[model samples]
Every structure is written in structure tokens, then in C-alpha cells.
Target chain A: MKNNIRVERAIHGISQQQLADSVGVSRQTINAIEKGRFVPSTVLAMKIARYFNKNVEMVFALEEGD
Target chain B: MKTSFLLPNKCKKLGKAIFVISAILGFYILFIEESYADGFLIFDSWQAVKNNIAIIGSLLGLALVAFSKERVEDELVMWLRADAMIKALWLSCVLVFLCALFLYGGIYFYYLSVAQYIVLLLYIFIFRYNMYKHIKNNEE
Candidate 1:
């Protein structure tokens, strides 16, 4: 899975901590998502996307191998 | 993430204190007291009581530490915990299998005794390491 969470955060001018707090998760989780080290569950993905006022497809996308 | 069957985050500190205190007590009772004794298997009534206390305390402490919730029991932490548990069980099983194959006599029995607690210890170690890496990777 690939995510443009970093880009989204930059565009929104929010730190990882802010996003994590808004999504009811830890900052490390936001970092992991941005780094593609961890994939969020459906609910979490939806929450993150909703936090950014975007759709899930806008923040996350399927990579060729994923 | 609706974490179930996990102790509250505060339990971690209490569990850690219990583990450390009991571990030190166990070490003192096992090694220091044994050194003054002539042979093995020499347990008086008080010694037996103290030994049992140490064993039970350690077990309870490890259980608390192993099952306590993280500060934020989010999905990622839960996933890391589950992953660590699976890895810990597999590794402990392998350790026991190797010990069975290569060890015998009293030493084998010693390791077998240790096998009871190794799973939880390994779980704690691996989970904490993963958490450390997770946090470190995010450091600015």
C-alpha cells in the first residue's frame, strides 16, 4: 500500500502529532503510515482521510505489488 | 481500538517494579543463599516460603507486563503486540525444542523451568523493541 499522508499533512499544515491526535492514534502510527511501514485498517484509513477532509482514495492508493 | 483483555497503561509501571524487585529477590535467594549451603536441594521451611513468594511474584509481574495496554492502545500498537506474541511463542517453542535435543540431566531441567517464563520475557523484549523502532523512525 502507498499513502500520500506526508503530502496531505504538508498541504493541510498539520504535524503528525496533530493528525494522530485527531484520528485517536499515536504519532508513530501516523509516521508509519507516511513511511509506508504500516498499513492502517479500514476504519483507521477512513478516519485519517476524513480528518484531512479528503476521501480515502485520495490519501491511499494501491501500489502495483501491493 | 477497543482493546480487550489488557491491563490499563498504569499497570506497566507497577508490573515493572514488581518484576525488578522479585527478580532481585529471586537472584539473592537462589545464588547468594545457595552459595553458603553445602549442596543442592537444601530448602528449609522459610526458604521454601520465600522461594514460592519470589516465583509467584515474578510470574504475576511478567503477566502484568505482557498484558498491560500501551499508553495509546491504538490499532497499530495492538497489531505490533499480536505480531510480537506470535513471534515470541514460535521462538520459545524453538528454544524448548533445542533444549530438549541438546540438553539432559539437571541442566535440562533448569532450562525447562526457565521455558515457562521465556515466552513472556521474549514477548516483552520484542514488543518493546518494535515500539522503540516505531518511535525512533519518527524522530525529527
Candidate 2:
């Protein structure tokens, strides 16, 4: 999966820690999602997108390999 | 996610302290005291009793550490833990198979005794290392 969490965080002018706190997770988790090292669950993906005031499809997209 | 199955985060600290203390005591008993090699493996001996205490303490400590929750018990942490456990099981299986093929006699029994605890130790190391790497990579 490909996610533009970094871009959304930049648009919202919030730090990873801030977004993590808002979404009830650690900053490392957010970083992992942004770096594509870890894939978030549906609930977590929805929470992250909701935090950015966007739909999940707007934030996360299907990669060719995925 | 529901992390009710894990021990409280504070247990991690207590677990570390217990593991360290028990490990040091176990080393002293196994090496300096030379209890196991004295041929007093029988349960009636003081050495046997002390050895059992050390073994139980170490096992308890490791169990606590293995099962305790992370500071932020999230889905990512749970995923890492499950991944580490599977890796640990596979690694331990390979080690046990190799030991079974190459070891025999009293030495093989010794290896078997220690092998029981290796999975927990490996899991803790792999999980903690992964968590460390995750945090390190995120540092700005």
C-alpha cells in the first residue's frame, strides 16, 4: 500500500508526534506508515485519514505491487 | 486494538529488574558456586534447591518481559511482537534440530535444558531490536 501521510501531515502543519497522539499511536508507527515499512490496519488507516479530515482513499492508494 | 491479553506496561520495568537480578544470580550459582557440576542434582541437596530457585526466577522474569505491554500498546507493537514470536520459534526450532543431530549424552541433555529458555530470550531480543530500529529510523 502507498500512503501520503507525510504529505497530509505537512498540509495540516502537524508533527508526527502530534498526529500519533491524536490517533492514539506512537510516532514511530506513523513514521513506519509514512516510510512504507509497516502497513496500517483498516481501523488505523481510517483513523489517520479521519485525523487529516480526508477520506481513506484520498490518503492511501493501491500500489501496483499491492 | 484490544491489548488486554498483555501485562501492564509497568510490568516491563519490573520484568527487566527481575530478569537482570535473576540472571546475575543464576550465573553466580552456575559458575562461581559450581552447584550443578558437584553431582548433587538430586532434589534433597541445597544446591539443587538453589538451582531450582534460580531457574524458576529466570523463567518467571522472562515470561513477564515477553508478555508485558509496550509503553504505547498499539496495533503496530502487537504486530511486531507476533512477528518476533514467529521468528523466534523458527530460529529455536532450527537450533534444536541442529543440536539434536550433532549432540548426544549428558551434553545433549544440558543443551536441551537451556534450549527451553532460548525462545523467550530470542523473542525479547528481536522484538526490542526491531522497536529500537523503528525509533532510531524515525528520529529527526
Candidate 3:
């Protein structure tokens, strides 16, 4: 339900806009995901994971409440 | 995953132009020309003209709002649309059920369809705007 996208982007030394452009999504969506205000779909989550060259589980994790 | 259901974002511009122009024409024929105060809800020449214009123009506008792609069409946008559609269907059903008790068959059918279309179009924009606003405010 939450993501470490901010940390991932920080590790790659890229801005949210750059990440969004890479993932074919809006920067606001990236921001929302990072803030835990929204959850991305499986396709989007996979796309984000692929962009980081990491496993999907490594990028997105389930919260205790979820 | 890719979905071919979406038109390019440019379609939204065309949709908006159609909606505005037709809306103006519809309103001009409907109210501004004072084509009223004569018949007993009859479909006379002016009434036919007004009805055709208003119904067709609004239906086009509503379809635009319903079908046109978002400026940034993503999974979240799709989810928002699905949510709006589900809620609109429920709300429109409620309206039909409530209105059916008080109205007859012919008018009931027309009113139900209009209610559904209006609810769906209005909620699509309203829900998306509210979600966008919420995200914007949260970012700030």
C-alpha cells in the first residue's frame, strides 16, 4: 500500500518529474505514491519496479494494516 | 499494460470546443430567443428546435466528459473513473427507484436516462477534481 519511491529516486539521483516521465505517469502520481496518499495499480507498480531495475516486492511492500 | 480505449489528450480540447459551441447554440434556441409561454408543454417548431439542440448538445458534452482521455491518463486516473462510474450507477439507480413511485412510465423512462447521464458526467468531473485538489493540497 506504500512505496519507497522517494528513497529509490533519491538513490538514483533523479527528481520526481524525471521518474514520472520514465514511468509514463504524472509527477503528481509519483508524489502521491510516495506520500502514501494513493496506491498504484499492479501495472504501474511493475513499471516503477522495472524502472529501478529492482524486484517489485523490493519497491512496494504491504503495510500491517493492509 | 496498454489500453487502446483512450484517445489522445488532444481529443479533450476538441470535446471542449464542441461542448461550448453547441451549448451556446442550444441555449440561444432554448431560452435566449424567448421561445416559450405559448404551448402546453407541446413539441411545436421552436420546442422541437430547442429540444433537439439542448438534448444533442448536452449529450455530446456528457459523452465528451465520459469518454475523453485525461491529460495524464494513468492507472490512478482509470481508478478514479471506475470509482466515479460505480458511484454514479448506484446514485442513478436510487433516483430512478425514488422517482418511479411518483411518475408514470413514459416520463419515468426519459427522466431516468437523463438522471443517469447527468449523474455520471457530473460525478466524473467532480470526483476527479476533488481527488486532484486533495493531492495538490497535500503536496503543498
For this target, which candidate reaches the highest lDDT against the unseen true structure? 2
List iRMS (one decimal) for every candidate.
Answer: 0.9, 1.0, 1.9
lDDT for every model? 0.85, 0.86, 0.73
- The TM-score-based order of candidates, best leading, equals 1, 2, 3
lDDT of 2 by residue, B1-140 (tens): 78877898788778878878877878797558765734446576777777766788788889999999888888988888888999999999999899989999988876866786899999999999978877898776
Estimate the TM-score of every prediction: 0.87, 0.87, 0.74
DockQ metric for all predictions: 0.73, 0.73, 0.60
Q: Please, what are the lDDT tens digits per residue for candidate 3 over residues B31-114?
A: 477454354343556666565656676677667666777777777677777777778777767777788788888677556546
Q: Candidate 2 on A1-66: residue-level lDDT in tens?
A: 999999988888999999999999998889889999889999999999999889999999999988
Error of 3 at B57 (Å): 2.4
Candidate 3 docking class? medium
Question: Model 1: runs farther than 4 Å from truth?
Answer: B34-45
Candidate 1 Cα lDDT to native: 0.85
Instruction: Estimate the overall C-alpha local distance difference test score of candidate 2.
Output: 0.86
Candidate 1 chain A — worst ten consecutive residues by lDDT sum?
A28-37
